[model samples]
Target: MSTKPQVSVAIQWATEADHPPFSELSNAQIRRWVRACFADSADITIRMVGETEGRQLNNDFRGKDYATNVLTFPMEMPSLGADSGLPTFMADIVLCTAVVDKEAKEQGKKPLDHFAHLVVHGCLHAQGYVHELESQASLMENKEIEILKRFRISNPYVLEGTK
Candidate 1:
């Protein structure tokens, strides 16, 4: 039997974009990605925001002055809770629609595919996966490739003419 965790995803759209369909960003898809990366059940909230909010949050929290594609905020919870049987992992993933669109176009990637990759990347971050070091980055990227493959998406790190 699979030991994948149960996932509860909450989506918040703070932008007025009619491009990417809702079905592409459904809870089931997000849950599947989370389950693939994490062994513990997770409660994750994905917030889609505009450039302004994304920039502000990035600057305030990460000290970066630009609006990135996705920002992850993992919530650490105490392990002493004995009541609820819900997942212990929790996180808030912020996706900047404008940045995602722009990067997708620049990278010659489909918006849905880019979004899927970012969501999976952010979910991995929530599970304490980081790419600060070369070894860590390789491990994380391999995991991402494996997960995206299941969704029939190509490796996101591959550039045009390099494959």
Candidate 2:
């Protein structure tokens, strides 16, 4: 029997460009990030889309005009009054494939590595990691570094200063 939590990953490409196996890697990355943060059970969804859809989502929800790397929509925590048998529903993470690939090339990083980092980032966001403040940003970055280290990836911050 499988012990992994039920996770739904949907890929939606608004453009004609074919991409890598993002869905499979995203699911594994999210599960790893979630396990690092929370011990309790979880259910989550991840979606990958093209620039047009990404821009639309960003404009509709975040009031941003351009497409972003990732966007996370977290679910409300279950209340005490709710059924105890219910599992934690974390959130949805929408990734922009165009943005991810472009940024990776510009940053001189492998596309797969960049995608893995962003997947971890989105998963962290679902687990309440935010960059609205310096402290939160530090916490999130540190966690990301730790998590990425296990996968043999270098620290993401090292590339930021040169770029």
Candidate 3:
């Protein structure tokens, strides 16, 4: 029996305005970006919500006033050895599409490419990647770049030239 971790993704979008290119981007595409940075057996939720819900979640959890592009809520639960031999749950990745679009334009990146970057970033956070320190930030950024490359997307930081 294979012991590879199962990758499961549940995606939700808010209304018509925040609709993502679900058909243009397949679950495999998003999953590949995530799996490249995380263990293959991870379970993730990628929710695309509007400003209101995004703002509420951000404020409630992070005490931020406005909606951010992506928010990660990790399960952080210990595992119970099961027949599947994989953790039952991982974390949730919430994305504000409106913010993503705006940031993409501001950062001068294609919407699809920016969306992929955020998905990769959010999934990494779900898998316990942090950017609180310079070292950690560098590591996370490197991982995001590697994953995005697999999808033919350029380095997000390079395009935005933040570094």
My TM-score estimates for the predictions, one after another, are: 0.87, 0.78, 0.85
Q: How does candidate 3 score on lDDT?
A: 0.80
Per-residue accuracy of model 3 over 1-163 as CA lDDT, tens digit each:
7666677777765683345544466666666666666655677878778889999999999999899999999997666656656655588888888888888888899988998999989988887789999999999999999888887999888856566
Best by lDDT: 1
TM-score ranking from best candidate downward: 1, 3, 2
> Candidate 2: worst 10 consecutive residues by lDDT?
9-18
Indicate whether candidate 2 or candidate 3 has the larger lDDT.
Answer: 3
**What ranking of all candidate models by lDDT puts the best one first?**
1, 3, 2
Error of 3 at 140 (Å): 0.6
Task: Give the clash count for model 2.
Answer: 0
| Candidate 2 lDDT by residue in tens digits, 1-113 | 74655444444444532466443455455555445544445566667778888899999999999999999998887665435755565677888888898988898787777
Residue 2's lDDT in candidate 3: 64
C-alpha root-mean-square deviation, candidate 2: 4.1
Better of 2 and 3 by TM-score: 3
Give the per-residue lDDT of model 1 (tens digit) for 17-43: 334543356657766766676667788
Model 2, global lDDT = 0.73
RMSD of each: 2.4, 4.1, 2.8
The better candidate by TM-score, 1 or 2, is 1
Q: How close is candidate 2 to the true structure, as a TM-score?
A: 0.78
